[model samples]
Target: MPRPKRPGEAQDVGAFPPAEAGITVVDWIDERTSLSPGIRWMLFRKVPKGINWAYTLGSATLFAFLAQAVTGVFLAMYYRPDAAGGAYESIRYITDDAFLGQFVRGMHKWGASVMIILIFLHMARVFFYGAYKYPRELTWIIGVVLLILTLVMGFTGYLLPFDQRAYWATIVGVNINGTGPFVGPFLSDFLRAGPEFGATTLSRFYAIHMLLVPGAIGALIGAHLYLVSKLGITAPPWLKAEPEPELLEHSEV
Candidate 1:
């Protein structure tokens, strides 16, 4: 060994220094893209002091929706939508042949149900706490629209298997749509693509399930999140009577 090294002496460096290399890459990207500030603002935003377990339902719902989207994408890769007769067989093949197919499909199915329940619970929490009053009315309205979209997403996806239950349930749903007085026939025809379900109907439901509903949900969620950031989390009822603290002042750069 060389002469005893000093306590703070530099050690031999490895050929690849992962930590330093990562920081350097991040610094390079941040310098050029200016992304760090926005990311920090989103990640480090302040919340009200009284936030409790009830506030977590919305985040849970979002997580469940993300799971559904991911699993749905994987399922879509092997799904056959154009052929009604082939739909069940395709699902069977996915369950039997594809890697992790059944697991992903099960997650998507259960995730939809869980998301619905969480969304309802979130709405209930907000409603019970009177968080929907006054400044948050628009937020509540957007949330209701999101809830409807989620329900529609489930309805459209229910028929993808093209099995007996799906077929009959869709028939009933289309018929129910047709009972809407003035727009009933048009709505029914649009959904079924004719008097009866066909290839067009399957294709329509698939498009709505995979693209239209998901896209709408994503846009609404973005708007909802922006509104939440702007308005901040609503304080609990008990905190309403207390005076709030003054905003913290920042020094000029």
Candidate 2:
């Protein structure tokens, strides 16, 4: 007969059995790479108190971007970027034939809009709360650059379908770029791959959308996160007048 649990005795559920295994793997990698310290610093760092729901916008924006990146990669697998009439048809095939392609494509499309809105909201929150002042100026600047890159990502992706709407919108966009000052003509020429949109333009947009913009955004995100970790999240204005002690220790004097 099996022994029953006694009073006040705890039942073992075999929870966390893999915890030791996970630690072993982490230690093995940490030994080779010396990554534990950095990881701990990043994960265990403290931030300002009294942060409210507005603080979540930045993380939400990051999540939207990551989702867009994943969905974009899946989309690229079947997307044909040729300027010839195939681009629209390729999109149709993906939406109609590929498994779950419609859902992924829809997510990528809507995710871009969500990311843009969230980023704007985040910037507004920071600006209104005065987080852009003082020691966080560089962070704000990087965030602005990130915002610009994100907009450019949207613009570039807009033309990938190569439909009438995309063609006309890109034409208008190129013309608008040409209206700028010193580098305007050069910029327009580069974007159109000559005087007007063609196969080269499609290729260029694809390269920018899929490679250059994402790479730039990724680098800026890394820098942004590093600064956030180092500077700590800004305290809400209504909080205590004095900054946190740890924040003062890390701030520029």
* Per-prediction TM-score: 0.87, 0.86
CA-only RMSD, every prediction: 6.6, 7.6
List of clashing residue pairs for candidate 2: none
Best by TM-score: 1
Minimum summed lDDT over a 10-residue window in model 1 is located at 244-253
Model 1: CA > 4 A from native: 1-16, 244-253
Q: In model 2, what is the error at residue 223, expressed in angstroms?
A: 0.6
Candidate 2 wrong stretches, greater than 4 Å: 1-19, 242-253
Clashes of 1: 0
The residue-by-residue lDDT of candidate 1 on 27-104, one tens digit each, is 999999999997787668888778899998998998998999989998989999865478889988888889888888
Supply the TM-score for candidate 1: 0.87
